[model samples]
Target: MLNLAKIGHFFLHLWRGVRELSGDDAYVQYLKHHAAFHANAVDVAPALSRKAFFKLWQDSQWKDVRRCC
Candidate 1:
């Protein structure tokens, strides 16, 4: 049982590390920020959907990078 527990903990950290390195946390962070913004704003805007967030993120990531090799 102890070994099993340790294995589970290891996998959990591995999953988190992979998500962080792969940008999977971007949408989650965005939602957190959006909630905080809305909490402090008098007229809050609706949060973007996941698909919209991913599209915007991808666009912003490559908008200024040159593809020429």
Candidate 2:
């Protein structure tokens, strides 16, 4: 039983590492930042929806020049 629990915890850590490497965890980070920085402001808008956050992220990724001249 202890070994089984260890394996499950290992997989959970591995999955989070993969998400961090692949940028799948960006929204989670964004939400954390928003909660810490903006959640208390009454005039601040709410955090973006998942779909909207991804849309905005994708747009920002391509709206700049990435290569050196």
Candidate 3:
């Protein structure tokens, strides 16, 4: 089981990687929006837990955007 601190660190790293790869604040904002949307959906639907939602979103094609270069 992952601790809260470890989970936080993992997310921080993910955000940093996304920011670095995209090199655009807009993409980061979009990613956050998608994450929030999925989070809310899972909250409202007990059948969909946060972990499962996050995993699904992480592998979702919607989360993939071309790098700005």
Candidate 4:
């Protein structure tokens, strides 16, 4: 029998796994990295919009793929 703490930990891990698999955290991480990368540059352009980001991501993902299983 699982205790409440065990069950809660399992659900937390499951939620995090789903977020990772779904790329839900990608944009947030991108913003963080982008901010760090350009912290002192000051001349860089703005970040990509969600639509543009997804388009670019999809394009890159498909560019080198030979077949889909």
Winner by TM-score: 1
Listed in order, each prediction's TM-score against the native is 0.70, 0.67, 0.33, 0.69
Per-residue alpha-carbon lDDT of model 3 for 1-69, expressed as tens digits?
Answer: 769999999999998888767643444454666667777564453334555655664577366673667
- Tens digits of lDDT, candidate 1, 1-69: 479988999999999999978889989989998998788787777899999999999888887864878
Q: Give the range where candidate 2 is weakest over 10 consecutive residues by summed lDDT.
A: 60-69
Q: Write the candidate numbers in order of decreasing TM-score.
A: 1, 4, 2, 3
| lDDT (Cα, 0-100) at 56 in candidate 2 | 90
Positional deviation of residue 62's Cα in model 4 after best superposition, in angstroms: 1.0
What local lDDT does model 4 show for residue 5?
98
CA deviation > 4 Å runs, candidate 1:
1-3, 64-69
In TM-score terms, candidate 2 sits at 0.67
CA lDDT scores, all candidates in order = 0.89, 0.90, 0.62, 0.83
- RMSD of candidates 1 onward, in order: 3.0, 3.4, 11.3, 2.4
Clashing pairs in 1: none
Candidate 2 per-residue lDDT, tens place, 1-69, comes to: 479988999999999999988779989988999999986688988899999999998788887786777
Q: Any idea how many clashes model 3 has?
A: 0
